[model samples]
Each structure stands twice: as structure tokens, then as C-alpha cells.
Target chain A: MFQTRLEETAAQVAAHLTHVLDGYPAHPVTDAMRYAVQGGKRLRAFLVMESAALHGVDPQQAMQAAAAVEALHAYSLVHDDLPCMDDDDLRRGLPTVHVKWDEATGVLVGDALQTLAFELLAAEQTHNNADVRVALVASLARASGAHGMVLGQAQDIAAETAGRPLTLEEITALQANKTGALICWSAEAGAVLGQADPTPLRTYATALGLAFQIADDILDVEGDAAKAGKRLQKDADAGKATFVSLLGLDGAKQRAKTLVLEAEAALSPYGDAAENLREAARFVISREN
Target chain B: MFQTRLEETAAQVAAHLTHVLDGYPAHPVTDAMRYAVQGGKRLRAFLVMESAALHGVDPQQAMQAAAAVEALHAYSLVHDDLPCMDDDDLRRGLPTVHVKWDEATGVLVGDALQTLAFELLAAEQTHNNADVRVALVASLARASGAHGMVLGQAQDIAAETAGRPLTLEEITALQANKTGALICWSAEAGAVLGQADPTPLRTYATALGLAFQIADDILDVEGDAAKAGKRLQKDADAGKATFVSLLGLDGAKQRAKTLVLEAEAALSPYGDAAENLREAARFVISREN
Candidate 1:
């Protein structure tokens, strides 16, 4: 049921994003962007909307943040799949943007998507309070800036050039910046929109994010190729470090379970309203891909 | 005298950008960002500061917008010079970002610098009014989004792949979106900060930007390589249609002069207060590089 809710949220976000992109001059960059964002788990959008629901923020008002996170997440995927970065040929069972269009389109699409995310948040439709909107803008910038996602990406690139795999602590730090930061932003956005306390959601997101990545590591070893879409176990093949490599498969699974539990417990303050978030956290490790 | 003022503003912007980047964790992306942002025209910064001055906006309060535009310009250049794009080896008589750093680092640095620009504009220091800050962020997103800068890039890339020269109107539209949009934003930023009508500055920038591009076309034909600090006449060599190619040498020069005059005339409403902007318009055509 929670999975269905996430799918529903994904659809909602997709529709909103389409509306947001309307009226732009049609170009390959826009086409690449559309293709890149077409399908995803929309986990970030789910987190934003669920988090907002728990805070009593109207979904209409929170849609911007929800869409914003998905847009940002999509941009990351587009860029990370570039020939210069991950060099992947497949994403969500479709050809990567660079492969489908061209590297120029890939780069510009990612660039535009990133800005479109910011533009969505900055628009008055997102929040009535200018202060709140600016805060959202500032927080997203921090979450995705050099101190955040970009920094994580650089470290990953550095590790490959260094010809040595990262250690556990380094991987954790790297993943925190790369994936965890955006997840945290999504979870906290609802609280921000409603001006509610963000501590509980922040805590929940930290554990949920770690669990999510651990699941990715586990799936690399165990997931069905057709379901995963992209190549699995590339990290292991490349001799790069990952949670499974660092903790052993069983150990990583165990840690993920503990984190999911912690993540669920963090939602206690919100009581029944946060049931969806708790289920979502549990879904992180349970999903096949 | 105008050259000296431009240098002074460049220094001021560089210092402010440095201060803004102070606490970011030291990494290759950060290093590349510093390297990429160092030593540029800083013409956009001058426009922001001079326009702010015309509106009696405090230079202190205006510094962030000035710095923000430069950071953004640096990002655009870094990405634009990537192997998939313009693929320049030299910029400012030094290695381009992808040449100086790896391609991955080049992409990350450009990505980070862009968000850093938004972060600076969203900061309270840019404007005391939350409304004003949000407006700045929104304007920037629009200026840099698909409808503006990225659309121009797509058109240019499309032209290259199309294997034919663009029509005069098409080149004009492409250049307007490419260089003109950001320049227009830079010229209008100060007015946005002061909450004043941006019509005069907008008009001034429209002509100045076209004239600026025309002059660049001229420089590519006649300027010394060492002075220009990058490959000149590459567009012509590539069989690209440019302002100079569309119009003859003398015709292009005559056009730039006419645009400069129009730019200066648009600044007349500010009287003596707009002298710097008028001078800037003249400088756009007169500079050798």
C-alpha cells in the first residue's frame, strides 16, 4: 500500500513537472531532460510528500518541494550517467541521455533540470512565505552544492583516479554527500513548509538514507538485472568499495535493518500520521531493486 | 579610466567570491572552482555594481549580486569549454577547466559554481527583503534555464550537427539567448536589488550585449592571439556563421558602433549618474580583446 502511495506520488510529481516545463521552447536539451526524468522510483518525491503530510502541510503547497526534489534527483541521475562520469549506457531500462541524444544535450539537460528544480522552489506557488521559499532555496543549494552532492561526486572521481578503493568511513562520508544529502532535504522539506519542528524528520531521513544506500549495495549482489535496469555489481567489478564490500553481504543487511528500525523509531513523535514514512523506511531494504 | 574601474570591480568581486567560498570543504572541485573563477573580464560584476550605483543601492549590499554573476559566468565557461562542447584548450591564456582538471572535475566544478551563485543570491546578505531575494533567485533561474542560456546552447549544438550555416536571424536569436540573456540579467540585477524599474538598464544591456558580441566577432578577426588569450577565428575556421561572417568586416564594425551609440543613449535618463554605464557601452566596442 505504501509502495502504491509512492507510485501515486511519483505520478503526481510527473504531472506537476510537465506543467512546470510547459511553454519552454522545444529543443533536444528539453527532450533529453524529459526522457531522463520520465521514469524513476520517485522515492524522494514520496519522502517530501509523506513528510509534508505528517506536518499537516497542504499537498498543493508542498507539491513544489516534492517536485523540486524529484527534479533534483533526476538531474543527478542524468549527470551521473554522463560519459564523463559513470559512463553508463542504461538507466531505468532506457538508454542514457548522452547515448540517446548526445553528450552536449546530456550535460545541458542536467544543467537545466538542476536550475528548474531551484526555479520550482523559488516560485511563489511553492510557498506563500517569501522567507520560507528562500530558506527552501538555500537549503537545497547546501544539499546539492560543492559542500554536498558535488563534493561527493568529486571524491568518487578522485578515488577512481587514485587506483584505490575507499575505506568504510570514506564511503560513508561520500554516500552521505552524494545521496544522503538530497534525501535529507526531501524529508525535512515538509516540516519547513509547515514551519514545524524538523528534528524528527531529519533524524528519520538520516537513517532512512543510509538504509537506502545499503539496500543498493545489497541489490548489486542480489537484484534481478531486468528489474534493476542498470548494470549491477559494477562497483564490485571495478574493485571500488561499497557497503557490501566493507561490511560483507550479511553484515550490511543487518546494519540496514538496524538503520530502518532507527528510522521508524524516529517517527514516533508524529504518531499515526507518520505511518507511511515508517513503511517507506522498511521498504528501503525490502525492495528487490 | 573605465578600464581601471573595471579592474577594481573585478578585484572586489573576486574577494567577495573568495569570502563566500571560505567554509566549503577543500577538494578538487573547490580547487578547480578557484582556478576556473580566477582572472576573468568581470564585466558582469561591473554592470551590476554600476547599475546599483545608478539606483543609489549601497555597494556593500550590492556586492553579492555582483559576485553571484561572476561565479555563474565562470561556471558557464567551464562547462562550455568541455570536450563535448567548444573543447577549448586555452582560456585567459591558460588551460581550460577540463584540461586543467579531469572531465569529471570539470563537470562537478561547473555544477557547483552554478548552485553557489543561487546560494549567494538567496542569502540574506544580498538583500534585506525576502521578497527581493526570492525575486533575484527566480530571475536568475529564468535567465539561465532552457528558455534562455541552455536553449542557446542547444541551438548552437544543433547548428554544428546540422552541417550548415545558420541564417542571420537564427544566429542572432542563438547569440541573444546565449550571451545576451546573462548580460541582460547582469545589467538588470542592480535594478532588481533596488526595486526600481529596470527598463533603462534593460535597454542599455540589449544593445550593449549585441555590440559586445559583434566586437568579439571583430576581435576574432583582427586581434592578436596573445591579447585575446584564446584561439581566435575558430568560428570562422569551423565555418560557423557569426556576426562578422554575416556582415562584412566594415559592416560589423559599423553595426557595433551603432549599437554602442544606442546603448549610451538609453542611459541618458540617469544623466551624469549613468556615466559609468555609458562608458561601459563605449568600452564594449573599443576593447581589443
Candidate 2:
């Protein structure tokens, strides 16, 4: 059920992104922007849709935010894959943006995609109420800016240069900003749209985000390259500290499982309405990628 | 008077930016972001504040929008100066962000600064009305995204690699999107905040923007490098087409003067109340830098 829903959202978000890109002038940058947004797992988009469904927000209304998050996520990946950054040549089974086009196109594509995310959120088509849209934009900027994703990325780079393995506690704090901030934003987006208290969903997303990172660490250790659609065990080669390194593989898996349960329990207030979200937590720890 | 007011707004905007960035984690990225934003002309921020004053918006309320445009402009410069883009070494007579820091820090600092721009615009302190803030965000996205600044930049890169100079008409359209979009946005932001018609300010900004670019082209041809605070004659050196190349230097100067008059005339609707904006148009074509 979770797999089917995730794929469905992925297709819808892809179509929406294509439609949006089509409106811009035909140029290499626009072409690269279109290419860059393709083929992610769309877990962030699915989180947005499922959380919105739980809050009784219309899927059409929620779709805008879903596409926004995916576009924003794509921008981050393109820049992250730059030679000056991670220097990765491949991502999602294809050459990364800088490798496929040039670095200039990669930079502009990422910059424009970030702008497009805020554009989507600010449009009236996203919501009838201006307050909701403003709130959404403000929260997203907070999640993606210096205090959140960027801060986490900076810390990771600093750690690499420092030539020391991060303590388990320090890595936890870093991941909470890097990957966890956007995940929490995706989960709580529905409540923001519906103007409801988001405490429960926030709690649910916090655990889910941590588990998701741990699962990623586990995949880095034991996952197949073909299944993951990218390089594997690169962290181990770099001597970077990861959940699998700090905790034993078995211990990391146990922690992810426990966090999944905590995530499911946090959704108890909505009962069966959150079954899909519960399933999503299980899928997080179990998925190959 | 224009110089005094521009400097005043520059100092205030810098201080506000510092306070906002200080709230984030202390890291290399944040430090680079702070460095990247310093020492600009602050013309965009001045336009925002000056236009806001014309619409009777309070200076305190207008300061948020002023800081937002400056941040956005700063982001564009950091990215544009990257080796993958223009590869500029000097800006405002200082080393470019990538030259001062590493490429990765340059990328991250630019990314964070762009997010900061939207964050400033969406804050409740920018305006009491949510509708006004949303409008500012939407217009800014349009001005800065693929449809505007990015499109112009891509065209520029393509022109350079195509091994031909752009036609007079083509360069005009490119500059309209490149430099003109943000100037227009800054000029009309006050009207947007006051919920008044922006048509007149838009007209004024259109001419002012063109005159400003023409002046830049003229500066490249004849102005002192030390006064310009960056390398001059790069276009002539590259054999790139510019207004001064297409038009004789004298012709370009005359054209800028005509546009400044048009910019000034567009403010007739506000009578003496718009004196500073009128002076701004004159200043655009006359400033050394």
C-alpha cells in the first residue's frame, strides 16, 4: 500500500513539475532544470500528501506543497553533487547535473529551482487564504536556511576537514538539521495548511526523520548498488562516522525499528486515518534505497 | 542628498542583516554569507525605501523589504562570481566569495542568502496584512527566477559560447530581464506594501533600470577602474557586444540621459513628493560606480 501510494504521488508530482517548467523560456538552463528534477524516490512528496490527507486538506491543494518540496529537494541534490561539494558523478542512476551539463548550468538550475519552490508556495493556486501561504513560505525558509539544512551541510563538511569521527550525539544533532528539518516540514505542512495544531505530527515526523537517516546509514553498509541506484559504502571508505559505524549494524537496525514504533504511536490520535503514515514508518526502515 | 540617503539605508540594512544572521549557528557558511552581503552600493535597498516612502509606508515597516532585495541581490552576485559562471575575482574592490572562501562555501553561502531573502519578505513584521507579504514574495520570485534574471544569465552564457556578439535588440531584452527586473521590483515594492497601484512606479523603474545598465556599459568604456571598484573593459576585452560598442560612446550617453528624463517624468503623479525618486534617476546615469 505504501509503495503504491508513493509511486502515485511521484508520478503526479513529476507531471506537475513538467507543466511548471514548460512555462519558462526554452533554454539550456530550463532544460537542465527539467532534467534535474527527475527520478527522485519522492518520499518527501509522499510525506506531504499523506500528512495532508490526515488533516483533511484537499489533495489538489496539497499537491502544490508536494511539488514545492520536491523541487526544493532536487535543487539541494544537484548542488550537493557538484565537484566542489561531494564530487559525485552519479545520482539516482544517472550522471549528476554538473556532470551532465556544465557546472554553470548546475548552479543556475539549483538556484532557479529554489526560487520556483517559493513561487509555488506564494501563488494563490496553492491556497485561498494568504495567511496559510505566508506561513508555509516562512516555515520552508526556516527549514532550508542557515538554521536548518545549510547548517547541517556545513557541519558535515567541517567534520570531514577536522579528520575525526563524530560522536554519536554530535552526528545525531547534525542529521537532525540536514535531513530531519525538511522531513519535519513535509510532515507538518498539512497542519499549517489546515491551520491546526501540529504538535502530534511534529512528534511523529521527528522520530521518522531520525529513523530515515539511520536506514540510510544501514543501506550504505549493506544495500546493493543497483537497488540504491547510486554508490554504496562511500562513507565507510571515507571513514565518516555513521549510525552503522557508531552502533553496530544490528544495533542501528534495532534503533530504527524502535523509532518506527514511536512514529506509529505518535499518530494514535488519528487512529485508522493514519494507517498509511504508520505503514510509511515501516517502509522507511525496510526499503532497499 | 541621494548619497546621504543611500548610505543611511545601506548601514541600516547591513545592521539588520547582521542581526538576522547572528541568530543562526556560527559556522563558515554563516560567516561567508555575512562577508558576501557587505560593501554593495545598496541601490536596490534605497529604491525599496524611497519607493515605500512615496507610498506613505512607514520607514520601519519598509526596512524589511529593503533588506530583502539587498540579500537577494547579494546572492546573485556570489553565484554569478563563481568560476563556473563569470569567474569574477573582484567585486566592490574585494575578492569574490569563491576567491575568499572555497567553492563549496561560495555555493552554500549563496544558497543561504537566497533563502534569507524570502524569509525576510514573509515575516509578519514586514506588514500587518498577509496579502501584502504574499504579493511581495510572488513578484520577487517572478523577477528573480527562470523567467527573469536566470533567463537573462543563460542567454548571456549562450551568447558567449556561440562565438558571436548579440544584436542590439537581443542585448536590450537580456538586460531587461537581467538587471531591470530586480530594479523594477525594488521600485514597486513600496506600492505593493501600501496596497496601491504599482503601474507608475513600474514605468519609472523600467526607464531607470535601462539607464542604469547603459551607464554601466559607459563606465566599462571610460570610467576609472579604481572608481568603478572592479575590473573595467572586460566586455571590450572579450569582444562582447555592449551599448557603447553598438552605439558610439556619445550615443550611449545621450540615450541614458533620455531614459533618465523618462524615468523622472513618470513620477509626475506624485508631484514634489517624488523628488528623491526623480533625483535617483539622475544619479543612476551619473554615479562613478
Candidate 3:
């Protein structure tokens, strides 16, 4: 039942994004923008809506925040697949923007998407106070920028072609900045839109973020390429550090289970109000892909 | 005399930025961040401060805005100078970030600095009103994003390698997005911080931004290589469109003078309240490097 609702919200968010992005001038850059944002798993947007629902926030209001987060996620993917980064040719079973266009267009499209995220958030009329918008902007900026995802990416690149192996703690820190930050921000920003105190939301989101990464690592190790929709075990081949590397398969699975439990525990204070979010947390770890 | 003050303010802003940025963790990414932002003409910073002075805004308050603009400008330059874009080796007499570090570091540093700009504005205690910070963030995002500078850059790259001569109007539109948008944003943001209505400020800044680009074109045509700090006449060599290409050298010079006049006229309503900004307009055309 939750999966069906998640798919519906994901489709709605993508449809809205398509409408907002379609109005750009018909330049190669604008075309690249469409290419980068037009398709995705929409996982981040789902997390935002589900978490917002947990706080009794209107799903419609949460949709704006969800779309913004998804835009940022798309922008990161566009840049990440560049020749200088992962150099991947495929994302979501489609040609990466850099492959479809050129590197320059890919870079610009990513940049535009990042800015578009802020523009969407800024245009939100549902939030009556400018303070709410400011906080949301700050949340998104930190999650997407250097002190967060960018920094994590830098560490990941640095870890590559280096002689030394990264410690377990270092690996966790890197993932926390790169992947965990945005995941956490999506939930926290949704709570902000719900007018909930951000402290508990952040705490809940952090555990969920770790669980998300562990699940991703597990998928890369055991999931089929057709099911995952992209290359699997690329991280292992690249010598990129992961929980699977440090914890082994059984230990990693145990750790992921522990994280999901802790994430659910963090939402206990909200009781039945957070039922959707709790269910989402369970699905995050249990999904095959 | 005004040149001396501009230099002094640039130095002060640079010093403050250095101090603030040093507080980050000293990783390679952090070092790249420091290197990318450490030195520049600080033209945008100067414009912000000068515009604030014209409006009788406090110098100290103006400096905050100036620093924020400089950070954004520096971030753009770092990204612009990457192997994927202009591929320049030198900036302000030092090796560019990509040359000094790697391309990934360059990319990450640019992302970090861009975030730092908003973080600086958001953390400013002087800007007590949340609405003001929100406006600043929104304006910066719009100017820097796909619809603005990034889009401009995408078009510039596409046009440059397309092997066709672009029309005069097309070239101007490109420059308006690439160079003019950020320059106008700098001046208008200053005016906004000074609590002045931005409509007139934007009008003045837009004219000045175009004028500034024309001056840059003229310099590229006739300026000395040593003084200009980079290659000269490369635009013509690369077959890149410019005002000088569309309008012959004499015609371009005449258009530049006309633009300066129009820019000055935009500020006329403010009378003496816009003296410093008006002087800066004259200074732009007269600058040798």
C-alpha cells in the first residue's frame, strides 16, 4: 500500500518538475536541463512527502520541498557522471546528460538545476514567514554544497588512486557528507515545512540516512544490474570504501537492521502521526534494489 | 583617490575572507577552496561597496555584502576556468585551481565557495531581518543559476565551437546572461541591502554591466598582455563573438561610451546620493586593465 502511494507521489513530483522546467528557452543548455531532470527514482522527493505527512504537514506543501530536493539530487547526479568524476555513461537506464550533450552542457545543466532548486523554494507561497524559507534555503544549500555532498565527493575522489586505505570512520564520514547529508536534509526540510521542530527531525533523518547508504551498499553487492537500473559493484571495483567493505556481508546487514530500528525509534515521539515515515524507513532497508 | 579607496576595500575584504575561510578543516578540498578565493580584482566586491556608499549605507554593513559578492564571483571564476570551460592556466598572476590541484578539486572548491557565500549572508548578525537575507539569497541564485550566468556560459561554449558567426544581437544577449547578470546582481544586491528599492538600481546595474563587458572587449582587442594578466586577442583567434567582432573596433568604442552614458543616466534620479556609483561608471570605461 505504501509502495503504491510512494509511486504516485513520485510521479506527481516529476510531472510538476517537468512543467516548471519546460518553460526554459530552447537552447542546448535548456535541453540539457530537461535531460538531467526529466527522469529519476524520485527517492528523495518521496522521503520529503512521507516525513512531512508524519508531522501532519499538507502533502501539497511538502511537494514543493520534495521537488526542490529532487532537483538538487538530479543536479548532483548530472555532475557526478561527468568525465572528470564517475565518467558513467548511463543513469536511470538513460544516457547521462554529459553523454547526451557535452561536458560543458552537462556542467551548466547541473548548475542550473542547483539554482532551480533554490528558485522553486523561494517561489513557495505556502510558507507565510520568510524565516521558514530562509531556513529551508540554508538546509538545502548545506546539504548540496561542499561542507556536505561536494566535500564527500572530493574525499571519494581522493580516496581513489591513493595508496592508503581509508579507515572505517573516515569512510562513514565521507558517506555522511556525500550521500547522507542530502538524505537527512530532505526529511529535515519536510519537517520544517510541517512547522515541526527541526532537532528531532534531524536526529531521525541521520539514522535513516545511514541506513539508506548501507542498503545501497548491499544492493551494489548482491542486486542484479537489471533490477538496480545501473551498474552494480562499481564502488567495489573502484576501491571506494563502503560499509560492506568494513563490516562484511552479515555484519553490514545487521548494521542496516540496527539503523532502521534506531530510525523508527527516533519517530516514536510522534506516535501514530509518523506511521508513514516509519513504514518508509522499514522499506528503505528491506527493498531488493 | 577613488581607485585608492577601492583597492583598500578590496584588501580589507580579502583579509576578512581569508580569516573566515581558514576556520574550515584543512583538507585538500579546503586548501582548494582557499586557493580559488584568495586573490582576484574584486570588481564585484568594489561595485557592491561603491553602490552602498552612493546610497549612504554604512561602510561596515556594505563590506558584508561586498564579501558575499566576492565569494560568489570567485566561485564562478573557478568553475569557469576549469578544463571543461575556458581552460585558462593563469588567474591574477597565479596558476588556476585546476592547474594547481586536479579538476575534481577545482569542481569541489567551486561548489564549496558558492555555498559559503550564502552561509556568510545567512550568518550575518547585522542583517537582522530574515526577509532581507531571503531576498539576497534569491537574487544570487537567480543571477548565478541556469536562467542567468550558467545558461550564458552554456551558450557561450556552444557558440564558440559551432563554427558560425553569431549576430550582434545574439552576442549581446549571451553577454547579458554571462557577464551582465552577475554584475547587475552585485550592484542591485547592494542597493537592496541598503534598503533602497531595487528597480532603479537594477536598471543602472544592467547598463553598467553591458558597459563593463564592452570595456572588457576593448581591452581584449587593444590591451597589453602583461597588464591584462591573460592572453589578449584570443577571442578573435577562437572565433568567439564579441561586441568588437560584431561592431568594428571604432564602433565598439562608441557603443561603450554610449552605454556608460546610459548607465549614468539610470542613476540620475538619486542625484548626489549616487555620486560614488556614478563615478565608478566613468572609472570602468577608463580602466586600463
Per-model root-mean-square deviation over C-alphas: 1.1, 0.9, 1.8
Model 2 C-alpha lDDT per residue in residues B1-289, reported as the tens digit of each score = 8789988999999998988888888888999999988987899999999989988898888999998999999999999999999999999999998999899999999999999999999999899999999999999999999999988888888888777799889999999999999999999999998889999999999999999999999999889999888989988998999999998899999999999999999999999989988988999899999
Whose TM-score is higher: candidate 1's or candidate 3's?
1
CAPRI tier for the interface of model 3:
medium
The sequence of per-residue lDDT tens digits that candidate 1 reaches over residues A99-195 is 9888988889988999898899999999989999999999999999999999988888788768777899999999999999999999999999989
**Model 2 per-residue lDDT tens digits across residues A1-289:** 8789999999999999999999988888999999988997898899899989988898998999999999999999999999899888889999998998999999999999999999999999889999999999999999998889988988888888787899999999999999999999999998898889888899999999999999999999999999898899989999999999999999999999999999999999989999989999999999998
Model 1 ranges with Cα > 4 A deviation: none
Output the better candidate (1/3) by DockQ. 1
Q: How many clashing residue pairs appear in each of the predictions shown? A: 0, 0, 0
Q: lDDT tens digits, residues A1-289, model 3? A: 6788778987899887878777766787776777777665677888888777777777777787888888888888888888888888988888898888878777778777877887777665536677888788877777867678888888888888677778889988988998999989987876788777877667778988888888999999998887776889998887777889889999999998998888888887788777777778888888877
Q: Cα lDDT for residue A269, model 3?
A: 78
Q: Write the per-residue lDDT of candidate 1 for residues B45-92, one digit (tens) a residue.
A: 999999998888889878999888888888888989999989999998
Q: What interface RMSD, in Å and to 1 decimal, does model 2 have?
A: 0.6
Candidate 3 Cα outliers beyond 4 Å, as residue runs: B124-126
The C-alpha lDDT values of all candidates are 0.89, 0.93, 0.80
lDDT, model 3, position A138? 76
- In model 3, the clashing pairs are none
